[model samples]
Target: MPWSLHGGSHLPGCPGIMEEVDKILIRSLRLSGTEIPDEVQSIREFTTELIVESVVRCLRVINPSVGAGLSHILPPGMSARFRIGMSLAQACQDLGYQGEVGYQTFLYSSEPEIRRLLLFLVEKLPRDASEDASQPVGKSTTLHRAIAVAIKEQLAVPWVPPACRTPRLQLLQGSCLLKRFQAQPLVLPWESNLVPGKVPPERKEFFVKFLPPVSAQLPQTTSLVPSLLERNMAELSAAQDWESEWKSQGLGSRMTPEEYRQWKLQRLQRRLLDQLRQASPSLGPAQPGTTGRDLIQLLGSFGAGHERAGALAKGSRFTHTQNLAYKQEAEHPVQVETIPISRTSEQELREKQAAELETLEGELGRLVGQIGDLEGQMATLGLTLTQVEGEVRQRQLGVTEQEQTLRVKGRTVELLPDAENNMAKLQVVVESSAQRIIQLAAQWEKHRVPLTQEFRELKALHNSKELESSRRLLEIRELHERIRSAADEAKHKEDLYKQLLVELESLPKDVSRSAYTQRILEIVGNIRKQKEEITKILSDTRGLQKEINGLTGKLDRTFAVTDELVFKDAKRDEAVRKAYKYLAALHENCSQLIQTIEDTGTILREIRDLEEQIESETSKKTLSNLERILSDYRAMKQENTALLGRTRET
Candidate 1:
């Protein structure tokens, strides 16, 4: 149930979904020339090697730190193979696999289990942002991808144990990166104790006796801060280099200064907002209020004024024409006095003055409107300031209350050890505990008496039974050895029979051969019947022997009990003593008679077995073959003698 694909809902059960999973896994793992069946029923067509390699590759893709340490190939030795299986299973489990997992799950993998594991791994494969074909890759994205790849490559290498690692102390010690770029320890040279000729003797003694050296305080080799600082410095250097490059070349590459300035301003604003958000993530996106908008507009207006000034300076120059005109009027004062003024000109001058007065009144009204707007803005700011002040006062009050509570708790802790009432309560608790322990010990003794007796009795019984079982086990082992030997003998006889039959078939044929073959077949059939009868008789004998053994043991136990009872009574009466002696004699005689009967039965069984063996051997015609061989040898000797006599006579 745990192996059920919860995240991979579209996988395993359906053919289409399984196919998709298979294809994705194959492509991602680069399983070339491997074909997955279209039907789910045929999923087992996947070999163990293919499955292991695919799973290992998928794990690497998902989590290189764990997967990289595992071997893709199964090891030849059973123990090493088991270790690898366990490692892979553990790695999968560490990657949040909820399914049941063990070494057998990987080493002795089944189709359904493999399918589920593969689907899980495929689902966990890291998705690439560049997978979206619609979006073009940027330089930053490319750089980030390259970094990720490099890190993954580094992580994928299996780590060597510290004891097995090659020494690199010299390389690390002489490296410029460690000397120039490493973080320096935080020092307080200006402190009174550290300052030259200002350190107190007591302080120096404390430093030497109690405090560690500065190197130990902030270790450059092992401390996390140094590594972090080193990394930060590296990043800072890279950023500075990029900034300098941009200033020298990037700025000039732009079409105009205005465009560059606008881009720079936007970049700075974006960076400022990012910093603000990081500083206080709880505060979401900033809202553009009226005050902020007004400030932006004011800055824009100032920029526009500067642009206008630049344009004016580039276009035309200003001249002092008005000053020259005033000088000319002063020099021609006598001529102007001689000229007479008309009445019509005076009337036109009065009309012009009235129009000018109306325009001045309109301008004064506009200034009053601007003042009202400024006053309203000031009032809003005052309200905001009031709210902030109230929040600050509330925080201060909370801090003061916390401090007071801390002081009260501190005083209580300081006095708690010396409190007389508390000490008295502790003594009472200890006395009560001691009494409870004593009562429990007494109760335990009461329970332990009967339990100990029962345990001893059970232990004795267990030992007797164990002895009996051991005796039976040895008997069973002997029986097994007998059966194995019997089986081997039977097999050897069978082989001999087949070999003789083949030899007979290869021999020259004769008219009498048919009769001989028929006779031999009949003999073989009779031997088989005899063997069956012997087997049945042996089985029956074994059964009777078991019954005899049981009855004998029962009789011995009965006699022992009866004798014990009679003997106890015999000590009190002469009649009982006589009866006890008679009883012992009777048990002895009966045991002898039983033993005699068993011996007779064993002798009869052995006699029957011997008769059967003799019959089977005779049925094979062994004596007839031996007699014919003897006659042939005599005939050859006679012919040799006749040939020697003929040679002598010639």
Candidate 2:
């Protein structure tokens, strides 16, 4: 058998060595907060086993033949040293360090070797293989160029700047030389002036030599040539100034003099062509055929340069004339008498203006004060208006209430006579009612004793029936309670039956022992007997219920018969009572008829007396009363007319 390193098979007699190593490892694992495997028992024993196994593994890695002999690595006396060694190796391995040297370094040299070995390994490792495999940094190739082209293609533009030629980025290093020259791309406008106090000499020369000569050539179109040459010279001088100005400004130096000259020539030709076209508008818009040819002629025409020269000459001449005038004015300045106002008048005028200003200021101050006063008054008026609104609302409410009271008074006034008449009629009815009540009371007194006796008898009978009904109600309640108790008992028996069924189902079928079998058989027999007894009881109870029902039917029949006999007796009593009531009513009716007859006789006598009195009274005073009433009515009407006239006068 051979031991192996890095998870290999174990040799014979390695168990003891392995056990020692395991003990040390387990101890170390426990210290490191690792749980010991169950197969490793205690730390010391596990350490012993671990050390032996690790020693064997290490020895095998060193030499396989030595691994076959466990004694070579694990001697009999070096158990502790062996445990320590194996623990170190395990710790190193667990921590992801390679080889037994790592463990030895940790224990002996305190891991200086690990750092050195790490540095060495890092150095030995290839640097960024993907980067090496990729395109060399900063060394742009055709492929990079192709990529750039692809980018430009994707951008849908073909032009690339010289700055974009290299892959090396110098973001802030390069000068923005193109942007410096951006504003002066065509020509520098500063070239129009050479210095602060001096005019351009070329402008004067052109005015004298080229432009004045054009006045002589105005009669012939062929005279355009010399002026064109003069203009060309002036433009060339301007272009030179532009170039010099651009250089002085240090904007850009890359633009060539030839390119500048060509650009200026083209611009000058364009300007000349435009001016020529404007000057000769009768020619209309240039024909398409001559348009290109005319442009070519303008560019080629040196005479075209004379046009700018002539304009510049005219401007310079005017400026020269002005300068001459200015010089003459400086030499011979005009003098005129100065009219001066007296200091006293000036002081008086100032005083008058000051007084006016003071008055205006005072007026402004007063106006401001007035404005404040007006604002205060407006606020006071607003408050007053609010108070007035509240008061008006209150007055309106009071007026509405007064109107409602007036309406109520008016209605009362309208109803006063009707209320008085109703009172009189009600009084008369009450007197009549009093007499009727007296008569009815007498009648009621006459019949009340017998009715009271009858009522007393009926009340006694009703009280006896109520007592019987109360007894019957008590019996019925007792029966309902008994029935409820019987139902509860039946429910309890049903629960017990269910419980017995569950037990029967739970009992095993294999119980063959005499005691269990006998007990189960006895319980089943008892259950069956109980069931039979319950059934018998139920049957007996049903039979008893049937007998009770029969007895109840007999009792009901007997009660019904008694009730019928009682009803017959009650009916006979009721008939006798009704007959008494009828006799009483008949007696009352007779009395009422006798009273009515007496009342009628009295009424007839009273009526006869009233008629006699009415006849005598009417014969004596009817005419006299009518005459008095007519005279009084006429007097009242005259007095009312006089009162109306007096009210109208007031």
Candidate 3:
């Protein structure tokens, strides 16, 4: 017995040997049917009973709230491999349970939660409660009640949490103060059950007694509470009207209440130093011997004792007006000397004719500045004797009466540099005959300026034809009366062309009878025969209106799409409703990520056998060479989901 799962094996290959029992019974009979294996020793006894029933339900699925009396706490040589579905694979390799739990694929799919955990534990199990009960893989009576009925049918009641419904139970039934004590915290309402003779009129025995007085036993206290002794004698008559103003100003009969409080504190510091010398005539004024330093800024602004310091010293006055000055001593006597005068005769002939008219206008302004320096040296020596007398009249007009600039200006300002080189060679022969007499007087003013503007525009057309008048003397006075009225209208048009040549030999005639020339030859042969039968019925009504609008937009979008691979029973009932919603959301997220990785009971079952080989390769069907081997299986499942989403996001 101990060899089946607890104490070990069914011998032949020892230690919980049936390795993943015929690979989970040929992947659960190829996920429950789909002929893939015709038999190779029937897939080796179907993976040795799916690895001896997943090592006899790997420790109730690795502690999923484990309890089902762990199959009578496992040992007994795996008690025939924990009965019915056998294989307690050596009690799950001696209890250190590894992964995968098939308990015959959880009792052939949760037989009503392993029969409600075999009627909840059913007293530890040596099997039968009418046998068929516990079934997380056929016939196991307990695994602590098939893991306490697959963890009490997998928990999850949570979603009902926010209980307060019905407008928050009518807002907590309006804060139920016992519904305002309409009383039920033990209701009585005159003992409620209504009218038992109006509940209370019970008369039995009676007793009257005279009980009263205690000063007459004493408790009434005030022997003079005349209104609390007239409010404490009106606060002792306002403390005797505050000592009756120093006892009617006689200063308490000459002082001694400690000298009448030091004569009312030196008459409130001499009426606050006469109200701070009548409120500051310069802070210095208070010094009539430090009137207690202006009684500390005038009794901290007037008002302490002595009838408020005798009304602040009868309204304090000596208002210190001082700033004086005035003087008066300088009265008589003083002296000093020396003086003289004269000069008359019109003050000395106007001082000698104004000193002879200022020395004759300073010798007439130095003889008019030496006659303007000899008229600027006789105007530059009369321009060098007028350029040596114009080079001796251009050498007497070029030796007509001259030569060599007339012998160099015939020597004057001493051969003025050979008369300035014979007056620069007779001024370059009078500037080359005055530039050919200014180019023949500018070509005689350019051909005499359009012949002097056409002789002044023909003297303005002889004074505008002397202001016009004759039309050749009125055409020779109307050519003898227009040649006698055109020879009397050519003798009256030669007798009206001889009476129209005798009425054009008398008669007349018509040209052509025309009804618009016979309606233009009958509209040119009826517009050439109704233009070829209206262009052949407008080309067959434009190709049947383009195939009836392309068959009404292909019956609204390409023959209405949802062809979902038409029938093989609607593609295997849509791939068994997409493999039961992708293998039950991939076996419920791979059994909650392998129960959060074996609930951290780590012994890494290679990422839970690679998430049960990605849930049997996502319920099959990806062909094209398995989509080219699932394209590097999505880059190794994106590096194993980025290393398990960074190990479950930290």
Q: Which residue pairs overlap in candidate 1's backbone?
A: none
Ten contiguous residues minimizing lDDT sum, candidate 1: 310-319
Model 2 per-residue lDDT tens digits across residues 1-650: 01112111122223443333333334333332234466755322323334334334433433456445443233333333435555545534443455445333322222123233222222222222111222222223424655976777656744446567443223223344223211111122234434434547786566555554434545554445555565567779876676456554322333465565555566676676678765532233555446557866544433423433222222333444455556655776645334356544677677766886796567556655665565567557756766897799899999999999999999778867899887787799999999999999989988898899999999999999888866776675577668868998898667656655544454455533365335445544554676698899999989987996797688557655755665555666977656555655675686688679779989999999999777655633456546745765676677778889999999
lDDT of each: 0.61, 0.52, 0.44
Clashes of 2: 31
Candidate 2 vs 3: which has more TM-score: 2
Candidate 3 residues 1-650, lDDT tens each?
10112111122222122232223233333332222344532222323234333322333434334423434222222223325333332344344434333333222322222222222222222222212112222223234555866656544322223354354444433344232211112221233223345444341111112323222322233322333444455658765665556445533254455566556678788875766665533234455666665566555545433232222332322211110101111121112111222444456666766886786567556655665565567557756765897699787686674566666675655646687787887799899989989999999999999999999999999877644524443453467458768988888667655544433343122312143234333333343344455576777767766875676566445323423223223545766666455544664685587568666755466678778666545423225335544654566667667889999989
Please, what are the lDDT tens digits per residue for candidate 1 over residues 1-650? 11223333323224544443344445434532223444423335566566777777777777778877877887655557668878888888988989998876765565556667776776576544112222334445556866987778756755665555445533323332354444654442234223367588887677667776555656555454665576567668866675555556554453354455556666676666656444432234555643345435434534523443221222211122333334544665423122235645777666766776686556545545554565467557656765887799899999999999999999889869789987787789899999999999899999999999999999999999878866766675567668868988888667656645544464446434456346445544654676698899999989988998899799889988998898899999999999998898898898799879889989999998888667645633457536644664576567668879999999
Ranking by lDDT: 1, 2, 3
Cα RMSD to native, each candidate?
39.1, 61.4, 61.5
Off by over 4 Å in 3: 1-51, 61-184, 187-650
User: Which sequence of candidate numbers ranks them by TM-score, best first?
Assistant: 1, 2, 3
Q: Could you tally the backbone clashes for each prediction?
A: 0, 31, 28
Candidate 1 has an lDDT of 0.61
Instruction: Please name the candidate that would achieve the greatest lDDT relative to the true structure.
Output: 1
